[model samples]
Target: MDGLNDYRRARVAEILADFTTLQFYIAAAPVDPPNQEDYYTEGWRALRQCAVDGQHILNTGADTHVPITKGGLEEQSKAELQQVHLDALGRRHQGQKIYLRQAAAQRWIELRNGILQGKKPAAEHQASLQACDEQLWLELAQITDEGIYADLQAADIQMGRWTGEDPSLRAVQRWIRSRR
Candidate 1:
């Protein structure tokens, strides 16, 4: 069980790193030896991919401004691993098919909630987050100005903000800055 859990965790990480929303959806389950189908054909695939991305960002190696019990690599019990798997799968099965664009919009909500609740850290993470925010903002802005809508579209979809449709230059800029 431990080995399987580790493998699955690694798989999830790779999926998150490899996809951006524009790529085809790689089905994680409910199918035999599931495989990825390009979004050009599978609409649902895009949504599932978006949810995966959202979960990854929110659960990055730390709390999303809220203290959730640590799990996965840091966890020791099978129950913890199971909970992580179930949580990820449940989100995929529940909720409307999330799109990358919608996911990005949701990031703002996460940030606001985290801040409103007074989720603060010792000055260390603050500087790191600020730098990350600035870098991502600049990159997104540059991409937007270059008229790289496809990239933004992929990012939006991966982030699960599908309802927002195509990402606007302003939205991408706002989302990037609002992070951390």
Candidate 2:
């Protein structure tokens, strides 16, 4: 019984550590733009490469390959992303950018500090960070894609949701950065 209890505790601690690291990678301003060394970003890189090369190993162990496209996937991806962003912004309420909840902003500051100091975030911090992420997605959802597009000027094209110097608010409106 003692051994099993110890194992459970250890497993919980390990999970918390991993979660903290992920939250740091996502919310930490220090690693803004997400370096390749950050967790899970490599998957996107691999997918993008596969899209361009027209190949994917369905089973890595078996080395089974599948082709997606012969070429120009990159360009197509850009265009689609641009269109998505334009569509989203076209529905914004007076071009409103990312808004952070006060509680989340407080947690964001604390989490960034913990990440910098290499400390695991407290459970409450994790919840707050998660809430912040959820709020952002919810706000994005409100930006209807079917909104008027003709009203958009070239200057209205915002780009990139890079993490920032500001803790209270993020510049998520400038998402996609297609630079049409």
Candidate 3:
């Protein structure tokens, strides 16, 4: 049973080595603007490979076929490099260039930090909702049943309502009513 576990561990180490090689290749590849998404996707894949590779490297002994090299220095370096790659991928995967939620969260954090540090400007220390101008506030602000009916009438282009007038709002409303 121990031998079986050892054998499995050795296989895992071998697989990890392959994965690390793949990651190195991905990291070394050049990126094109239009294919940036593809490049990032590949980067993520590479990071995943590195994680698997590092795990197997740890699982198997340094004396195994997977060479740790001169007190495991090379393997250690590779593992560290892979970890950096993984972190980079994780940060990148968190959002796209114009993600709304990420931008909002970042903005909120920045605002909070600035306020906490007393760096925020006196005029803009906190986010505020702009009040409606009193001059612009009219009876339209509080819509009436008549207004809703008028809007429904205007929306109906066809004379489908009870009114027979071709261009009247009621006619349009009637037309719409028939369709529904």
Candidate 4:
């Protein structure tokens, strides 16, 4: 049991390190072309892999001779591991927001420059700008959803009950107040 616990801890540490690397990659990703899909794709892949690995550890520990108290501790650790993933998702979502905003701003600038240079902005440019706006809204919706999910998970951890309320309402209100 002790050996299994040690192995689980080591595996958790490795997953956390991988998550940290993924966060850094997400943060440093470029907003412009020659766009790199590999970075985003690989980061997501690594995150999902970490999740699978954590689940595997939990399942394996359950099958082992882990003591009752130790098993409870492992369960708590698993919850905390889930929180880490939620936090990573939040960070990645923010990074995507930044990238989308930058891309939109760049497109608008290009459109303005073209007008100033006596060239009508291409229809494709207009379409691209609109697409960026739509994408931003979609990303924002996803971020909000992730935040709500994280809040629910947090409530479950802290209160041990799943209350199906809109956890992000207060956060949204606070943001609105700050903007005002």
Candidate 5:
């Protein structure tokens, strides 16, 4: 009985140590835009592992008395950390959306000019415009934040008006607006 209890306690301690390491990694993850998705994925994985290990420790029935909040393993702390990761992801996506919007606008102008000057057929111009619209919609879809999604929807509506591309643009606008 004594040995079994000792083994359980040791196991709990080991799991807690691993959980703490994951916590540190999550807290210190870089916010670089290019690698933001990878960082967020790693942070989310670590958070999930910590939660699983914490549950396992609780199930062991060992003489574990660690206070989660004080030790930086509390549920509230995890929630706060997850929020930080989410906000970082939102910022990165927002920056990407801005860049894509500008590029799409420039491309639309060039395509329209080509069509008007007979450098390209109207059908070719329309196809190019449709591709650009699709790319912008895809970029917007990658963002998960509701506020950012709403902002992108408004921007897309404006872009549609400026480019005089109504049908496909209106479809994208409706889809984005309907998303929660």
Candidate 6:
């Protein structure tokens, strides 16, 4: 934390505090019976390791010089937490994979339509999309759940559904618009 600018030093201090809190929670977590090839458990392990890595960065809570790093403890912690979320989402939607697939297709169409109409960024993207065959483009609607999930992952977009009693499409449309 030494030899750094005031802003960087403050940011590092905040990150370190977050790591300490995360470490405490990780240590206090109940022991879950291990499941074979469990992605959720693996994510927790990665997160726990990230907390431990932070301690190393801080020299076991001793004051230490930290150099600027893109792949530091903070970055790894965020990545691990995101993985945990994705894993949970996949598990929860296992039964409604078809629904998720359809939703993903709809999102795809929405994105492409925005780009093609110049409602979204990149005119070059619009030109490329315009050249796409209309019939072929609609084929995205028939993709498998795995295919849809792959697209979401590659795009770094989180996909999920609302189960609220209100069946209004407005909430969903607003969400899509925000993303665009």
Model 4 poorest 10 in a row by lDDT: 58-67
Instruction: Mark the regions of model 2 whose C-alpha exceeds 4 Å error after superposition.
Output: 1-119, 148-180
How many clashes in candidate 2? Answer: 3
Query: Per-residue lDDT for 1-59 in model 3, tens only?
Result: 11233333343343344345544443443333233332333223333443443344334
Clashing pairs in 6: none
Worst 10 residues of 3 by lDDT: 129-138
Best of the candidates, TM-score: 4
Distance (Å) between predicted and true CA of 107, model 1?
Answer: 25
Question: After best superposition, candidate 2 residue 74: deviation in angstroms?
Answer: 34
Candidate 2 residue-wise lDDT, 28-101, digit = tens: 22222233433333223322332322211111122122334334665444344333333333223122211112
Q: List where candidate 3 sits over 4 angstroms from the true fold.
A: 33-180
**Please, what are the lDDT tens digits per residue for candidate 4 over residues 1-180?**
223444344434543454355445444543332223322432233333434433333233111222234456666554444334333333333333333434443444444445435444367556654554455445434545446445435644575432232224445334323322
Return whichever of 4 and 5 wins on lDDT.
Answer: 4
Please, what are the lDDT tens digits per residue for candidate 5 over residues 1-180? 112333333433433443354444433432332333323332233333434433342343322233345333344444443333333223333333333333443444344445446443357466665664565455445544455455544664554422121123334334334321
* Candidate 5 residue pairs in clash (backbone atoms < 3 Å): none
On lDDT, the stronger of 2 and 5 is: 5
- State each model's CA lDDT, in order: 0.38, 0.32, 0.33, 0.40, 0.38, 0.37
Alpha carbon RMSD to native, model 5: 20.7
How big is the positional error of residue 19 in model 4, measured in Å on the Cα after superposition?
9.5
Question: Which window of ten consecutive residues has the lowest lDDT sum in model 2?
Answer: 54-63
lDDT of 1 by residue, 32-117 (tens): 11223222212233334555755654453421232345564444444454444333322322221233333332343344335435
